[model samples]
Target: MLELLIIACLQDQCREFSKLYDPAEVSLLTCMMSGQSEVARWQAAYPEWQVDRWSCGERSTRAARL
Candidate 1:
C-alpha cells in the first residue's frame, strides 16, 4: 500500500510525494534501498536524499566500532 506509493514516487521522481509524506519515511525507504544495485538509479532520482552505498562489511565494521 504505502510501499507501492513510495516506490511509485521514487520511480516517477515526484516532489509532491515529499510534501504529502513524512521526510523520515521517505528517508527510511531510500536508506533501505541504498545497499541494493538499484541504488545508483534511486540516488539519481532522489538526489535530495543524499543516498550512500555501504557494503555489509562496511556496516559491520561501523557497528563494531560503535
Candidate 2:
C-alpha cells in the first residue's frame, strides 16, 4: 500500500540522517500515524531524542461545525 511505501522511504531517510547527526541531538515532530510508530521505534532504538505528538482532528471538527 501507499502508506507502507511512504513509511519505508521515511525510515530510509531517518536512517541516513542518523548517520550524520546523532538522533539524541535531534527533535522530531510529526502527525502521520506511521510517523508516530516510527518515532516510538526510534525511542526504543535511541532512547534519548525528544518526540512529540499532536492531533488536530478535534479542532478541525469544531471548525467544520461553525
Candidate 3:
C-alpha cells in the first residue's frame, strides 16, 4: 500500500494528515505524480494553515494523524 503524507503548519503549530492508497490501485509513481494536487486541495479547504512539506511513502511510516 501507499500513503500520502501532508504536513501543515499554523503559526508554529503543525499537524499531519494521511490517507492510504492501495498499491493494487495506485502505484508509487502515480502517488508521487499526484501528491501536489492533493496537498493543494487540502490547503484550499484550510487556508489558515500553510503546507510545510509532503511526500509519498509506505503505510505506517509515520504515527501521528489528524
Clashes of each: 0, 0, 0
Worst 10 residues of 1 by lDDT: 57-66
TM-score on alpha carbons, each prediction: 0.25, 0.29, 0.85
Top candidate on lDDT is 3
Which residue pairs come into collision in candidate 1? Answer: none
* Local accuracy by lDDT, each model: 0.36, 0.32, 0.88
Query: Per-residue lDDT of 1-66 in model 2, one digit per residue for the tens?
Result: 011111123332432112122234332322334455655675677554343332212122233221
Q: Candidate 1 vs candidate 2: which has greater lDDT? A: 1
Q: Looking at candidate 3, what is the lDDT of residue 58? A: 85
What's the true lDDT of residue 47 in model 3?
A: 95
Error of 3 at 19 (Å): 1.8
Give a tens-digit lDDT track for model 1, residues 1-66. 112112223443533221122444545455445436444555577666543223221122233221
lDDT of 3 by residue, 1-66 (tens): 689988889999988888689999999999999999988998899999999999998887465454
Query: lDDT score, residue 34, model 1?
Result: 45
Model 3 local distance difference test score: 0.88
Sort the predicted structures by TM-score, highest score first: 3, 2, 1
